[model samples]
Target: MSLARKFATVGGATLGSRLLGFGRETLMAAALGTGPMADAFYAAFRFPNLFRRLFAEGAFNAAFVPLFAKEIEANGIDGAKRFSEEVLGVLFTVLLVITIAMELAMPLIVSTIIAPGFVNDPEKFDVTVKLAIVMFPYLMCMSLTAMLSGMLNSLHHYFAAAIAPVFLNLTLIAALAYGLWTGADPLMTAWYLSWGVLVAGILQMAVLYAGVRHAGMRFGLRRPRYTPNVKRLLVLAFPAAITGGITQINQLIGQMIASTKDGAIAVLQYADRVYQLPLGVVGIAVGVVLLPELSRALRGGAVKEAANLQNRSLEFVLFLTLPAAGAIWVISDEIVRVLYERGAFSPATTATVASTLAIYGLGLPAFVMIKALNPGFFAREDTKTPMRFTGISVAFNCLLAVSLFPIYGERGIATAEAASGWLTTVLLFVTLVRRGHWEWEPALFSRVLRLVSATVVMAVSLHYASGYLADWLTPQARLLTQLTALMLLIGMAMIVYFALAFAIGGADASMLRRNLKRKPRPETAQEEADTSVLPPPQM
Candidate 1:
């Protein structure tokens, strides 16, 4: 498939998943609010969720996809399958052991590592521990699912893997609905949700495994042995995993700091959910498609093609994210109040969440840029450099978060995250340029400048538009009125932004049109032969 079509397939599915995620968050806001129960549930969810992101989504795929693709191209189907089986055997064994250990150590982890603040409230602390234990098995399921997803993506079957997350949201939403209908206690409802997480993990893994099978790859469990390729994969994956772990650790630090204040953790979680929509849809989708594509291009000695793809991906990300960041910053309050601020969610909570979302919005472009740029290094199997950069960013985040938390509270934590994101993006960009892995063309730079200008125009328009609808956005406004005003405001802002972008030469209308119409490039024998001698990826 064309790059744009692959991106759309993954991006569209991700959009569906994110929309359901928003619904799930909305229900949770109404059902649990920012109370202790909400805090406990989110805190519990955060522990396993962080590990899942690090191990399953971020690090594993970064290392797995490129190698798996190389194997498929070079060694054919059977070679790829054998490699996958070896990796799976070792991976499953490791994950199984870790899950068992974590389950046993849940109390210690919850009390010290995950949410130390909960220690002051014995009930909350105990509840968090229980919920975490219930959800811990999700780690194993998702880690395995991630491996299967790598296989599917390598085979150019992106939809099933991309859409698997919707099941998680669906499962959670159902649990929340049942809790409400049955009038279950808040703690009981959280318990139900934790179990739902486990079930969803299993279901998501099953879906992806089925996809891999349908793609004509069947994996069976074998003795846990690290064959030569598996050993190479592990070596490459270790640094990437460390990088992912550092990112997660930064998040954990923020959560720990947020946990000191009542309801701060939940507030951060809610804000994160809001910004994650754009991040997942654009940033993640680009990363997913770009890595394999770049790897293939480079393997085929199509360096120019690889560079063009990177430039286009960067342009697309900025084009989308800049406007998204602007709109979110402009209408954060209205968005938050409309989506949340119901039931037990108070106006004060809404305001806090809105401010947090605004700060996160400021970093949205940087976050997306990181996603786009990292693939440049990763596709060439240069995980160590990114790992080093991630370390620096995480250190900065830790120091800044610690310094600012006393003054700015949860907003400080959000600010630290945004600042660190930009720092990481800049570092990655500089490294890429220095290594000649990425080059900034004049057109790309000009377009980026124009995109920024267009975003400013959109922001100014949204500022006034929001003022005009201030009454409808108020907490006391009817829900329908609030929703209608918010939707219209967003729609108008999108129209203004795109129009300004096109007028200012910020966007390439023809390029996008071509992207939509471009045909898939068939794999050539020369390309396969080129990949046959693909040297083992550098550590």
Candidate 2:
């Protein structure tokens, strides 16, 4: 399949899941608002979710995919299956031990890492601890699921793995719908949400495992042993996990800091979910497809192909994310209010979330840049470099978040996250350039600048369009009016951005079709930098 098609398959599925997430969060806003119970649940859930992102989605795939691809290359499906079973046996055993340990240490975790801020309020502290225990087992299920998802990705069956997350949203939405229907109190509703998390984790893992089977791989249980392969996986996985899950690590740091203030955790989470839409669709989609594709090119010693993957994927990411950041920055208040400003979500809450979302918008491109760039390292089996940068970014995030939160509150936390993301992006880019992994080309820079120019025009237009729609976006307006006004703003954004991009040579459908329609060829260095809409970069 073409790169764009693969991205679309995964990105389309993620879009569905994100849309469902919006529904789930919308109901959650009504059920819990930005109340104490809301803080308790989000804070509790963030722990397991953090590990889920770090290990399952980030670490497992980063370390496993290239190796899995190698097995496929060396010995075909049977060889890969044996390697998978070996990893699975060890993974299952390790996850079981970790779950047991976390459950036992839940209180200690809550007191220290989970939410030290809640300790003064004995009631809230107790609730966070209990909720975390109920949800922490999710980490195990998702970690295993991550393995299965990686298998599916390596096999090029993107849809099933991508679609599994929809079940999580479906399960949670059902849980929330039931709670809201019963008019349950916020605490009871949070309990429902926690159990929903556990159940959804199991469901998502099952779907991915079935997908692996369908992709012509199946396995039974094996003894958990530290084989040479498993040991090597561990060595690569630990660092890759840290690098892959950098965003979550930074967010976890922000969460710890945000916990000290009432309602801040949930507020940040709401904003995080909103911005995660574009990240999941574009950034994550590119990362998933690019890793396996790049690994294949490198494995075959196709330097030109690998370089094209990096540069073309970069083009694809900026093509989508720049305008999204613009939209979020331009009409954050309207978007937040439309999605969240009802029930327990007051206008004051909307203001805070909007500001946070806007700050996050500034970093969206950088946030996704890591996704496109990291594969440059992982495909070559070098995980430590990205890990070192992640450590630097996390530390910067911690220090800056601490310094800024007292001054700007939640917005300060947002600022810290955006700044750290840009820092990481610059670090990754410079490293890739210095090492010659990334083909730093002037045409790419020209396109990026053009994309930015187009985005600025769209953003300026959106500012005025939103101002004109302010009355319709007000709380007094009917729900339909709010929805219409918001949709209209989004539609205008798409129409304006894409047209301007194509007109101004920021994008070329023909060139994209030519370059990304197939893997790069040895003779296509000129094609890689064809003077279609713009000339090739000066050497």
> What does the lDDT come to for candidate 1?
0.87
Worst 10 residues of 2 by lDDT: 530-539
Total colliding residue pairs, candidate 1: 0
Candidate 1 wrong stretches, greater than 4 Å? 245-247, 515-539
Off by over 4 Å in 2: 522-539
For each of the candidates, the C-alpha root-mean-square deviation to the true structure, in angstroms, is 2.6, 4.1
Cα lDDT tens digits, model 2, 1-539, are 88989999999999999999999999999999999999999999999999998888888778999899999999999999999989999999988999999999999999899888999999999999999999999999999989998999999999998999999899999999999999899999999999999999999989888888888898877999899989988988999999988998889889889889999999999999999999999998999999999888777666777888888999999999999999999899999999999999999999999999999999999999999999988887888899999999999999999999999999999999999999999999998899767778899899899999999999999999999999999999999999999999999989999999999999998657866754666566455445212111111
RMSD of 2: 4.1
Best by TM-score: 2
Q: Tens digit of lDDT per residue, candidate 1, span 1-539?
A: 67778889999999999999999999999999999999999989888988887787776678899888889889999989988889888999999999999999999998788999989999999999999999999999999998988888878899999999999999999999999899888899899899999999999999998899999998799898868888778777877776655556777889888788999989998999999899999988998888888888777666656767888888888888999999889889889999999988999999999999999999889888888988888888889888898888988999999999899888899899999999999998987788677767998899889989999998999999999989988888999999999998989989998998999898877667664332322454455445434334445
